[model samples]
Target: MVASPPARFSVPAVTQPRINEANRKSVGPLSMPPRLLLGPGPSNAHPAVLQALSLRQVGHLDPAFLAMMTEVQELLRYAWQTDNRITIPVSGTGSAAMEATIANVIEPGEVMLVGSMGYFGNRLEDMADRYRADVRTIKKPWGEVFSLEELRSALEEHRPKVMALVHAETSTGACQPLEGVGDLCREYNCLLIADTVTSLGGVPLFVDEWGIDLAYSCSQKGLSCPPGASPFTMSDRAFEKLSQRPGKVPNWYLDMSLVGKYWGAERTYHHTAPINMNYAIREALRLIAEEGLENRWQRHQANAELLWEGLEDLGLVLHVQKQYRLPTLTTVRVPAGVDAKAVTSQLLNDYNIEIGNGLGELGGKVWRIGLMGFNSRPENVILLLAALDRVLAAAGYRK
Candidate 1:
């Protein structure tokens, strides 16, 4: 009544939840069961690469990291067998590099001729279309490589600005023979972009000799490294086209003009690069260098031959012709009455082996077996053949 002093308020003490071990969620440390990767990609990374990946992380722009980046570029050139100054690893997986090659060099409305041999070739056509290019395709049945004459005819007829092809079709296990096609591209004044995703380290790819204007490959397939930091190289002709584009590159992150500066002397920042992946790839390339490319290619070929012979013994027919078949990836026609997916599942679940089933049109018709990178070994071939034999036999498969 007499204007009493304002009472001070205080926060009431509230009891917190009790910390009990019984109430806490139980989670264990990371541990994955051992697996033999015989699929199209990500054949178990080499021990050296795994160790490198676990090494200390560094800033993308760190001096040591930059030096390593330069080394990685040089090593990639060796792996790709090119002297292209614009060679570098794209920030994402193989598809990112594929997109970069298309988004930068192929301007909207420009005619692009694609050789559709298999699933990957179709992918190239799709990427080019996304760039708004006038895409024209010369398709061969899946598992068949395009002949040089066919390529020449398409190039002459369409006279497209770019001719894209997949060096190794993972879906069909066919290897496109570059051969005189590069000269054909030169004659037609067309740029050649090769998707070497399945062939980069395991197959013979002479970019300069073959006159490939641009190429992209994944790290996981034949590089014996985890997926990410894909290899991308562009020749002077391709770079010139990229530079002369009237409009800005449709993909900001994959724009080679800006990405090149980051990998070049300018060392500009474009994005937060996958530093550990670069380290892993560098070590993988180092392993490649230690084992010469010819030796590595021969190892893949030899192991593939073993697998082929084993499959033959099992009475399984190969999908691709022997001449054009990719040594890194083998597609086996699923025998009549035998489930392809079931075979792969049994191999993974029972044998701890992982093989791939077909993609797109070939799904359930074939099984894609990859003898790539660290997984390309005589013992692996033997294990896969034995495991496959068991699985197919149990599935009631017969010659």
Candidate 2:
């Protein structure tokens, strides 16, 4: 044995390869055209918000950052018109916040009633199903709003733990009225979740008055901030349901139990927060605060009215009826033989303007124009109308 162990086999040593630099390309400085964002969302961020985004970043746990976090929550409360202490900004886009609300409050096997009027409503059903909820969807055609009676019937029949509705259906330019929905939900002992992504800052949203137990919105849409930090609020009743969950929240990242502690007085560390996005959102909220909600809402309404009149003058019909039409986003039916994409493309390429194409069933059949947040201006309305006239004429479509 000693003789056999005397000589061990030696392995060959290969030389390491050097880095290849020949194929590497150096990226140039950032540059882009100044575009008028008239799309369904992400209308131009306020200049102050853009400036705030460039300010130095800070540690997530820094005291200054924590104070800013509290301010952001306060601003969100103002924007949502709610006094709920659970209001905070989720560190993702609106959909993440939407999922956070749906996943936490509705447990597996619990029924969830979805009022599907447009794309976002159907999306809510999808998100609810992903959480293994017993989903029951009551749908209306696209470009339509759900009546209170319809929602009441669905809630009574399904007896769901949650009733989800879209406050503003961006996909169809319809605003679902929430005047009595909260009362209806209360009568059924169900939580009300309002998707306010397109309504939050640009229009009237009385979270407490409307009795919405949970509501979620995005910065990019109505707050005029980049699409990252999204606003979310949970009523005490909703949080109570979340706290009493038999099992841990299915999503670790969106667990309100853990997230609440960080955003609440506990100030615990959960995840590294998006500091710059928070800064941008904070400044955006400040802008909202300075302008006041009523003024902002009026501004949006005025601009939208102008747009509606202009579109009609151009012989374009609106998808949603006037009574239910959304002030923030407008969906126009593509003229009988017009190409929606071609119209949008021409606006982008020739005019540096951006508008959204229809989603889901309405794709290529309509165009979505947003007059929201900072982009909701009379001048913008006039400009977009003029641009559309030129582009449509070029497309050989007569007014």
Candidate 3:
């Protein structure tokens, strides 16, 4: 073979595949309906926040980007009213941050007690199950919240390593009061996790004061940003538990011991952070800082009350009781003969409004209307009320 010079052969020309005209469909520039999102999430982002989202990109590790990241962290700390050293945003939706808490804090066989009052509580149980936790749930009907006594009884009965509660239940529009729940967990030697996904910026939340060992939220709902990046924080107590874990975190992407370095002083590489989402959230949080928390909370409350009054004026029944109702989301009971889906559909199609049909056990029974972040304005409340009155009259509902 060597003597024959390997019998030199000529290669045939290769034709790279081009765009197949048969399979390729012509597409035009992007266009979307200007939908006013008044549903159980993804409320319309503030115009300024959207502008930040569309701003130019930067390398994930650029020094300017790193500085911006620090600003983002400080702003987030203000938003959550926490000084947790490891506060950061996960590079996914709110649910990803939800799982991050379970993944980092739980070992395979640990007992985890969840307060399952609404759909998201069930979600917590499901994620805990996937992590191989021995899950226990203390239940209540949708549109209702567990009392401090109920939680104390559950903690005494389950004696779990971790206890999780939803600070704001999105599905049922109920805000679970957490003022003393954290102390109860401490008495039982259990870590506390709070789901602030629907509460964080819009409602009053005190992570450290309430002793929330771990907490998570979404940017889309209360932060007035898009849905990609989510807020997550852990107290020293939770972090200490994580540090003593017998094994590596079960979910690698969400392992905070590794992910924290990137957000902390070490500045190590984790995954590429969501630069644009960080920018968007920083701007949104900045707006919050400028407006002040008390003012924002008042704004959201005033607007929600406005909506509730208008709904009641229309003879629509509120789902949750007044004291437990969430300021960000409201559940309205469907009139006996009205089709819930039809009402929601009319709101979306005719009025350019988008309120949610119910979820889980509430489907076809209640309508979820959101007044969160930037969307929580008196003008929006008036618009939605006017639209709903018209839509309901057309739907053949007596009231």
RMSD (CA, Å), each prediction: 5.3, 5.8, 4.5
Candidate 3: residue 304 lDDT (0-100): 95
Clashes of each: 0, 0, 0
Reference-based TM-score of each model: 0.94, 0.94, 0.95
By descending TM-score, how would the candidates be arranged?
3, 2, 1
Task: Tell me, by lDDT, which candidate is best.
Answer: 3
Q: Across residues 1-399, which tens digit of lDDT does each residue of candidate 2 receive?
A: 454433456554555535345533544577999999999988899999999999998899999999999999898899899999999899999999999999889898999999998889989999999999999999999988888888878887899999999999999999999999999999999999999999999989999999999999999988999999999899999999998988999999999999999999999999988999999999999999999999999999999999999999999899998999999999999998788899999999999999999999999889999998999999999999999999999888997
Candidate 2 whole-model C-alpha lDDT, 0 to 1: 0.92
Candidate 1 per-residue C-alpha lDDT over 1-399 given as tens digits, one digit per residue, 9 for 90 to 100: 666546565455556745555654665677997999999988899999999999999898999999999999999999989999999989889999999999989888999999998888888998888889999999999989888888878887899999999999999999999978889999999999999999999999899999999999999989989999899999999999988888899899999899999999999999999989999999999989899999999999999999999999999899988999899999999999998888899999999999999999999999999999989999999999988988998999876
Residue 259 C-alpha lDDT in model 2: 93
TM-score of 2: 0.94
Candidates 1 and 3: which is better by lDDT? Answer: 3
Would you list the clashing residue pairs of candidate 1?
none
lDDT of each: 0.92, 0.92, 0.93
Clashing pairs in 3: none
